[model samples]
Target: MTTVPPEAERLLENEPVMAHFATCADGRPHAAPVWFRYEDDTVEIVTTGRKLENVRENPKVALSIQADDGGDTQWMVTLLGTATIVEDEAETDEARRRINEKYGAPSDAYEENELVRIDVGTASYRTY
Candidate 1:
């Protein structure tokens, strides 16, 4: 597993931060905000619909998270990686728990959701 940088690690673990999950299909880009869990040097998100379909066709993906307090200070992190649909029932269940907890979702919610894991290949951040 690749080691997550300290700054990126903090951002990933923060529960309230929303990540923009991006995928490409047929040269078109698609992105959406998501509640995510970062662990074992991987980013996991439970989602379905077009995002899932895009990753199925193209494993390459990106995740961007930013913070803005409406002040001069701002920071952002972007992670580039390859995403795989998680098929193992056990892993999917765990992912569901983590994602739901992060977003304060009811325990029963997201149980039937699909899981996607992104193995981060590169990460970059900017602060100002």
Candidate 2:
């Protein structure tokens, strides 16, 4: 697995920005916003519905995150990775808390969502 660059990691961990998670299944692509936590070389997200279904069907995914101020872009990062669906209830709960904490939400928020960890294979970033 490729590691996220230091500058990109700092941006990801410091900003509470929404990531655009992308998945493709059966020749169709889907993208949606999600709250995420970045640690080491992995990006974690708790999600349900179409996003969850897409990941189960196809583990290949991508994520895009940007830091902006007053609608002006400052920096952006894009990650390409393979995703794993974490079925352990305990791990899911812990991941939920971490993600929620980053976004300043309640610890138990989105309890019904399943955890998906993306093992980043490629990471690229740019600053404006």
Candidate 3:
């Protein structure tokens, strides 16, 4: 497994930005801002239905976790990665906790639903 650098890790951990994950279908790219978690250089995000459907249609995707700032944006990481859908209860629970610590609590009341894990296949960074 490839390890993320400190800069990349920080940009991921505390940038306080939502990731816009893009999935393409029928020559169209669908983007969604989502909360995610990072563990040992691997990033994981949770989604219920739509994202799953998109992933099912296209396993390859591009992601960008943009930093929130006006002039001179803080940073942005964008690259390609192979997405694998993971449907493990224990893993989802862990994802819940990690996501909470990073972003915030889930919008809906807690209930175990069909959760998925997006493991970063290959991650790279770009600065402007």
Candidate 4:
């Protein structure tokens, strides 16, 4: 069993912001901002909007969690993973709870929308 490095674990456990998710389409990348929570070896995010379309068309996804600054020096973690849809209510609810805990509870606006999730398959990190 591989253990998460101390630096990696610390960065994730105390991350200040959510990263953008990019999915490949026709050799190009579609990017969007998303909030995420880490569980075990995976990073999960909520998006019942745009992500639903991107992930459906291409399951291959790359997600990044990093400091929200335009400067060249920033801490970033990039993940290469297969984004599988979580259609199960329980699973979705669990994801909701985790997300709410991290970013605050979901708005009533989310209730009106359909939300699907993406699970990070493999993660890599870089701090500059």
Candidate 5:
């Protein structure tokens, strides 16, 4: 796995912005906004329905995050990675708590969602 650059990691860890999670399966692409937590070169997201199904079908995924104020852009980071569905309930719950805490939501939020961890293989960012 490629390590996330320190500058990009700082932005990823500090920004509470939404990430655009993208997945592809059978030539079709799916993307959705997700609340996520970034730590130790891994990104955790709790999701269900189409997003979850797509990840199951395809472990390869991408995440796009940007920090902006009003209409002005500050920086954007894109990550390409391999995703794994975490089936352990305890691990999923812990991931949920961390993700929720990042977004300032209740610890028990998104109880029905399953956890997916992406091991980042490539990370690129641009600051404007």
Candidate 6:
């Protein structure tokens, strides 16, 4: 697994930016915005539909997040990883808690849903 830089890690943990997630479909790119949590050097997401189907067929994926100050400052982080469809209920529950807490959602209202774990293999960032 590739190590995320300290600054990038801090940003990921604290920033609420939406991640642009991408998966391969028939050797082409399919991308969408997603709410995600960064933990244990992995990116976690709850999703269904085409994104889930794409991952099941091809585990490789990419995600990117960016932040801007509305002035002259901006930063972006990109990650490459292998995505796994989590089937274990226990892990899914834990993912629910973490994701909800990160977004200030009702933790007790956690619902069982499709979970995806992206084990990050590479990370890159740029700030301007």
Q: What is the C-alpha lDDT of each candidate?
A: 0.85, 0.92, 0.69, 0.68, 0.91, 0.87
What TM-scores do the predictions have?
A: 0.89, 0.96, 0.79, 0.77, 0.95, 0.89
List model 5 lDDT by residue over 69-128, tens digit each. 898999999999999999999999999998899889999988999999999988888899
Can you list the residue pairs that collide in candidate 2?
Answer: none
Please list the residue runs of candidate 6 whose C-alpha ends up more than 4 Å from where it truly belongs after superposition: 71-73, 108-112
Rank order by TM-score, top first? 2, 5, 1, 6, 3, 4
The candidate that wins on lDDT is 2
What are the per-residue Cα lDDT tens digits for candidate 1 across 1-128? 55567876877787467899999977988999988899767999988889988998999999998888875548888999999999998888888887788888875586767899999999887888
> Which of the two candidates, 5 or 6, achieves a greater lDDT against the reference?
5
lDDT of 6 by residue, 6-125 (tens): 889899988888899999988899999987899767999887788998999999999999987875548899999999999987888888788878888886444745789999999998
Name the candidate, 3 or 4, with the larger lDDT value: 3
* C-alpha root-mean-square deviation, candidate 6: 2.0
Q: How many collisions per candidate?
A: 0, 0, 0, 1, 0, 0
Encode model 2's per-residue lDDT on 40-110: one tens digit a residue: 88999999999888888999999999988999999999999999999999999999999999899999999
The order by descending lDDT is 2, 5, 6, 1, 3, 4
lDDT tens digits by residue: candidate 4, 1-128? 32445577677766648778888666689888877776555667767666677788888888777774676647777777777777776677677676667776653324433345445556677777
Q: What is the lDDT of residue 49 in candidate 3?
A: 64
Model 4 regions lying over 4 Å from their true place: 1-6, 68-72, 106-109, 112-121
Q: Candidate 3: where is the Cα deviation over 4 Å?
A: 1-3, 106-114
Clashing pairs in 4: 48-115
Where model 1 places Cα greater than 4 Å from the true spot, the runs are: 1-3, 71-73
lDDT of 2: 0.92
Candidate 2: stretches off by over 4 Å: none
